[model samples]
Target: MPGIHPTTYLFAARALRDFGDGFVAILLPVYLLLLGFSPLQVGIIATASLFGSALLTIAVGFLGARRNLRWLLLASASLMTATGVAMSLADDYWLLLVIAFAGTINPSAGSVSVFVPLEHAALTREVSHAERTRMFARYSLVGALASAGGALSAALPDFTTGIGLERLTSIKLMFVIYALVGIAGGLLYARIPKRGASHETSRTPALGPSRAIVLRLAALFSLDAFAGGFVVQSLLALWLFERFDLSLAQAGVFFFWSGVLSAFSFPVAAWLSRHIGLINTMVFTHIPSSVALMLAAFAPTLPLALALLLVRAALSQMDVPTRSSYVMAVVTEAERAAAASFTSVPRSLAAAASPALAGALFAASYRSWPLVICSALKIVYDVLLLMQFRHLKPPEED
Candidate 1:
């Protein structure tokens, strides 16, 4: 413990955050469906939540620049935990929409999804430059495993007895549990900054550092995320239901494996990056992965289809860490947080469009179309990844 850095609290918070958010991601679609919501409506709710979370990242980045991260983190945790509690108690659709959009808490899924970069920037400020990529790789590893565990926990309902309780009730419980886990993570977060509250904090300058390139990446990220929106949970659940008659629990299992395969794939990808470069690692892995996703749409059996999904999961996320690392690597060290937000904001907004689109398609019995669109959009991103950044490399370790 003597040599260990003080900021490890972020990792613990990230792991717990992933566990809670993973559960919410699996169940929220089913929750909306039980309320008699259409696919489009379900998609809207999902998109709203996404935008809500995305908007907060800006606040976090801004606030984190001048404020103590511990205080900012604590506040984000409180807001998110409170929102999850609100989600569990709310019954009306409009109010749920309000909560979804207005919520500010940085639950694990949302936090690590966004905050890890903040963590990276923070740690980069605290540690030597030589270790940044290594730190990020470790951070991503923690999140992947935690989320995979949460995804697997989706099977819990399979063991619950009886079906008379409104499905809404069970879904609310999932939200409650997710919130509690987040609260627990927040509590644990108190321990993450091991150096204690006495540690001095400095403010970050808000001025833009590499304006043009960051915005370009953000634009491309938006395209990929917008396409991703179609396959949001309601649509994915609806996809399985219409196509394979899969129950929520069953689809949860599929998502569980999806996370599992994703969790396992990153390490291999890190290895592959050594040979092909991070940018190449992003495209080659993704092209085949996108094709597999398209094929899953036509799968004849649940097992075979699940196999395709698992394969897609394995290859698709290989780009995640590399993509993240590439963005950080490309910009000047001072601009890291802005670079993360520039790309991440558009990514969030683009994905925000999907749920509503998927829902509309479902109402028209054209839910399957979104998958095709999603695939095409993703293929474009993969191509862009290859052509745009293939020659880029990280600053070599000292």
Candidate 2:
């Protein structure tokens, strides 16, 4: 850790956490099915995880301004470790539900963990306004690539079964690995400086002048998150399994390629933001991706659906880095942590509401409803975002 930059520690921690999330997202539904739970139960557990993350994130946002972010990050890492350990050992429905709510299992490609707002605030402090977007892009790229690797690793269970290992034992081993990754992430986070080189203690409220803008953005983000929850990776994997009878190995391969496409798009998004501005980059790229998702829901053949899904993956995530940069750019330094938490909390809650409904639809054999609803709502969010924010450029833009 001596020669490494502090930001590098953050990047490494992100990679470890994201790798765990990526595979968990793919494996959660399958694991639940193996345990004799219905799809609705799987969706409920996913909601519990997001909802708990939102509540914890709210606490972090409020406390982050006063506490050492390094300690807070370390604490989050500890919770992640505990979550994984509990998950590996528990099979009871109620106990698993409790762990899902209290632990760090993510059912989506994007994280809603307590780590997100903390890391966003930390990353913003490490770079100047001019460099913020690209820094976030690199941060996101690291996560995406690591997630791709994790997605590929989901096939380990399939391979292990071939070697005469019990399928259930192999799946449980993945959770144990998840716990180990949390410990590894904790070690890297410990290397981060206790405070930024330019850090200063401030007693001002976490949100002041930026309160109105932050609230509005949070509302809009909530809409998008709600739409996204319907197609959270767990549910999407369920769709593939039910719709096409995809094997776990096949789903793993598809998601790995999808994650890779998303990872590479981060830099392209940074470049696109420079040319078209963050809001434009977010809106324009998003519309087409939503359209692709909608079409994929109706595609008749497996190949056609997979091809459309890959197209959606490539364009859908271009907004991620840009969105993080935009939020950080608009808020004051003191408000950065609060701003991140505030924006993310609503998004998490909104996202938490839908998975159950999507699962119910799937349970009823209306397999396409979730995807269609998700795409339509996402398109609406994109249009609304452009209308409200297109002219409200960030400080760097000015």
lDDT of each: 0.69, 0.92
Best by lDDT: 2
The residue-by-residue lDDT of candidate 2 on 1-398, one tens digit each, is: 37888899999999999999989999888888999999989999989989988999999998888788999999999999998999989999999999988888999967677999999998898899999999999999999999988998998999998899988889999999999999999999899888732345356687889999999999999999999999999999999999999998999999999999999999999999998899999999999999999999999999999999999999999999999999999888888999999999999999999998898998899999999999999999999999999999998888
Residue-wise C-alpha lDDT for candidate 1, range 1-398, written one tens digit per residue: 35656557677777787777777776676677777876667777877877877787766655554555666667767776888899899878999888877774222233324454466565555644344545555666777778777766765665453666555676777788877876887785565453222223233354355677777778877887787777754467567877788876677677777777787787777777767777788789988988988887777788887888788888877877777777777776656665676677677766766767777877888756888888889999878866775665677521
Relative to the true structure, candidate 1 reaches a TM of 0.89
What's the residue-level lDDT of 276 in candidate 1? Answer: 70
Q: Of the candidates shown, which would achieve the greatest TM-score relative to the real structure?
A: 2
TM-score of each: 0.89, 0.98
Question: Poorest 10 consecutive residues of model 1 by lDDT?
Answer: 194-203
In model 1, which regions exceed 4 Å deviation?
1-7, 104-116, 126-131, 162-167, 194-207
